[model samples]
Target: MLKVIFLAAFAVGTVLADGELIILNNPGSVHFEGSQATNQSFLKEVFTVVLGYTPKLTQPWDGVEIRDPFLLPEALVSIVIEGVESVKSPRGKHFPLNVDEVEEVTWQAVSRRLEERDTNNTLVRIRVGDGLDALGQSALGELKPNSVDPASLKHLSLNNEEDQKFIEELQLLRAIAQKIPSTVTANSKPDVYWFVVSGLRPVMDLHGKDSEATKEALKLLNDAVNDLSNAFTDIYNGQVVVALFTNDANKLRNTRSVESPRVRREEKAGELETFDAAAQNSSDNLNTIEKSIQKLATDTEGLVEQIVDALETTTQDSEKSTTESDLEERKDDIDSMHSSENDYDPGKPITLRLSKRYSANYPVIFNIFLWFGIVFFFSLLAICIAIAGMDPGRDSIIYRMTSNRMKKDN
Candidate 1:
């Protein structure tokens, strides 16, 4: 995850190169303070004992002798090359590249030189692309360095294959990796670095301690290495990833710490409590709503029954026969009697007439009473509805229990 994060952060300025060299700490000169004579003797003795090959005094670049144990003497060759040295500094005298004692003599310088060479190669690519685009247009003129070019890279030319290759390689490298400064801590102190090699062989220091935060960090690094090794199948490829771990693990481990178990538990409990309370309240509201709906159903049924009873009584009264013929004749003489006697049919269609004329004539008086009645009735209903909605389904108990358990877990 960390690696992913880093890659994203520096995505803009990254490049990929064909052959990559990730140097964690540039191999620097080992300073052995003494006279030149003493130093030379020490180096000779050291190489003889360590390499099991006697080295003789020879000119610079001419490598010393080595006797192969398995190969015959005639077959095993002794190699030599050009060698030169000066007894004085500030003149032409110089130490070997990796053996320079200057603090600034680091792998970063070497890497940067390599990067710039790659960058030069990349510049050529831009020209190539531009040339391709202008194939039908203008001439793809030869490009050369301007007069303002620095001493470190005055010789590089766009036309030169070596220079072009260098730049191209650098551009490719930028695609693959970025020179990011990673912070690693040791004894609470930190060292900021630009190169974080993914793989290099893990070797113990003088104290035999792995470059890691602690014991746990070491174990994690080892485990990661093993996993990567198994997955890659290519040991060399696997080492690249391991290199990244080996260099940063110790510093990364020291700077980082894990959360305590108790704190995490408490946090979970609080969350559970909050959720439980909310669920319980919602359940109570649901139950209350259900009860109000039931009451409304009952009231509506009662009103229907009263209406049916009133209609039935009127019907019976209308059917009663009168004893006096004069009264019967008078009732028969009423013009609306026939219409009033019309049967209330349950199956047949019925028409109900509603008029706004009566309401319009007494608007002010009716509106006041009508609105007041509606508001008062509904207000009371709303209160009952609110209660029924609260615990209508009786689910609050279950919700509360579940909530409580969640709170504890949290």
Candidate 2:
């Protein structure tokens, strides 16, 4: 018996899941005729009676009509208000309040009313219809908070300076809500979630006549409407059942749904690829520089060894006179080279010295042939010294010396 009951419950739940559950917020009567009445009746029956969800109606006798009986798990509901209407609240008389505003404000009045009742469902998504276009236009251009009649302000009970400031903020919010656009493009997930808003109606009621206040109310209302519309539009674009109360429901009969916008995944992929390519190019350049540095270090070591050998050979005294002259001329250069020992690493520093005595002794060129021999020999030594302190390889004087010697022998 338990197994049979479980199976039966599962089947019913599956069937219910296939259709959408709609929650309607109707505070007043909306008259309809002809095809508009038919559509409203159809929608009401399908959403409330067929789907087994109750309509939240402030006035039951003035319930809206529905014409179509479509099963949609997701829906976009539009709230349409036709003309100027006022409702009495705790604060004062509120004018031009639409179904959307009322629903939001009512939900806030009762703590967690929607959430506690529909634990598994979300609040109905709402959109403003074009019927309120004239109101929105008036709010944008002609509304002013200071223009409200001071007589209507008598009902406001202000206890302190803070209360007045709070009232002012409420007036601003109401004006912002009024200036919001009616049509919204949807861009939300298909899942439904409840939204409860309060404190708006009282503010609207208090400052509805002030153009600035109305503009503020319109802006706030439009932001909320657009957010709800975008949330629904992101997921579904099919036909939606709209429930609204107006003197002429015929205006809402022709209301159409908007399609969801397309996302560009390809552009995102291209950007990722470009970033990866740049990273790889940078890595390759760094690797090349590292290898070049290693080669330079090895060549520098070889040049250091060549300089040490040349210094050792030049220091050997063949004659006493020649030794004294060479020592005196090379003293300054040797001292400078030794000072580099403390400044650089032992194996990294390159020191080069040319004998100053050679220049001083060969000041006169009376014996041209002898002078040429001395100049040539010293020039070769100077070249070796300069090359040891500079970059290595083919550009070095060592290479030139070897090549020239080889060519002379050949």
Candidate 3:
């Protein structure tokens, strides 16, 4: 009777295996100098839960496989596999993944409870994850969503002695990526999943673009690129990509053939050196552009304050303030300032936050300037009058002009 009960329970457990699980890890195009063990460990942990099986550790660069064989010792009996492939997509034509063709794959158990599903019945979906390091995650969490404060950028510029715009951009990219769903479900089915990782970094330089600042930007960008590349080495299952661009002639010259090209470019002589030169020039240009952008941002902020005050003042003016047409125009101006709102999207190429929440502040400096100018002008006029009164020739003219005798003499 005890043996019969044991057999019945074993049969029940096998029947209860209701769903299939898959875990995948793919390497991106660019390889990092260091980063192997961490990625393997991450993959092992992810698969251990997803697939009810222990992984056979091997070199990630070569390839590893797990099988769903029935003869294997039934110690939880789940299979896990890892593969590398080149994923082709029309959307990201110039993406690093598109160029490198390195991807990882695995299969895991859906959950501890369900086991009926198998690899044949389930559609496997795969994607990359935009892995954020501790610093990256911390930085992103601190930033406001869809809230690109121009003031914040100015503050960053002033505080960051290194002038690390690339780092700032990286933070921005993380915020943008976070808005999108992390996992992709195959055919809208819950059983299958794909995870993705998109890397963000700085592009190189161009021809005739040699300067110290550009060189520094290039160095900073390269450092980020290298750091990110190394970070991905440990995340074995998700696709990894390095984001590089050639938006301008100079950028093209710098990155033409250096590595992954995110932008279209024409081949030039000494592309590597051209890129190096462009990277150097980019620093100076960036400083100039940053200053200009800061000034514009400040002016816009001031304008916003003035508009808000005007609106409040008119609101209080009950009957004697601005007209309906003028108020409407003011509203229109405010709306126009955020015209970029009409073009916000997650998948769009240019992700710029043109519409942002603004605050109103007292115009202390402006008011002080106005009051001081008025008072100084009046004081100067009084001094001139006093000087004229003390002058004998000028005093006679003024005194006689007001006198009854002076009128008779005239």
Best by lDDT: 2
| Every candidate's lDDT | 0.31, 0.39, 0.37
Shift of residue 85 alpha carbon in model 2, Å: 4.7
Give the poorly placed runs of model 3, Cα more than 4 Å off: 1-167, 170-208, 237-239, 249-410
Which residue ranges in model 2 land beyond 4 Å of their true spot? Answer: 1-73, 76-194, 205-208, 242-410
- Mark the 10 consecutive residues where model 3 has the least summed lDDT: 73-82
Candidate 1: what lDDT? 0.31
Q: Which candidate model has the greater TM-score, 1 or 3?
A: 1
| TM-score top scorer | 2
Q: Which candidate do you rate higher for lDDT, 2 or 3?
A: 2
In candidate 1 the C-alpha lDDT for residue 108 amounts to 34
> How do the residues 1-410 of candidate 1 rate in per-residue lDDT, one tens digit apiece?
99787445433222211111111111112112211111122232322222223323443332222233232111000000001111111111112221111112222332243344234211111112222233222221322212222233433443544344333332322321211112111121111112221212121221124333223223432343233223322322211111111122333233333434666788999999999998998788767766765666566556556645565565568575344564446444442433333332334557779664563338668889999999999999999887677763336754665675667988
Query: Across residues 240-267, which tens digit of lDDT does each residue of candidate 2 receive?
Result: 3333222222222222111111124556
Per-residue error for 155 in candidate 3, Å, reads 19
On the 0 to 100 scale, the lDDT of residue 42 in model 1 is 28
Write model 3 residue lDDT over 176-233, tens digit each, in one string. 3343233221221113222322221121222112544444444433443334333332
At residue 372, candidate 2 shows an lDDT of 93
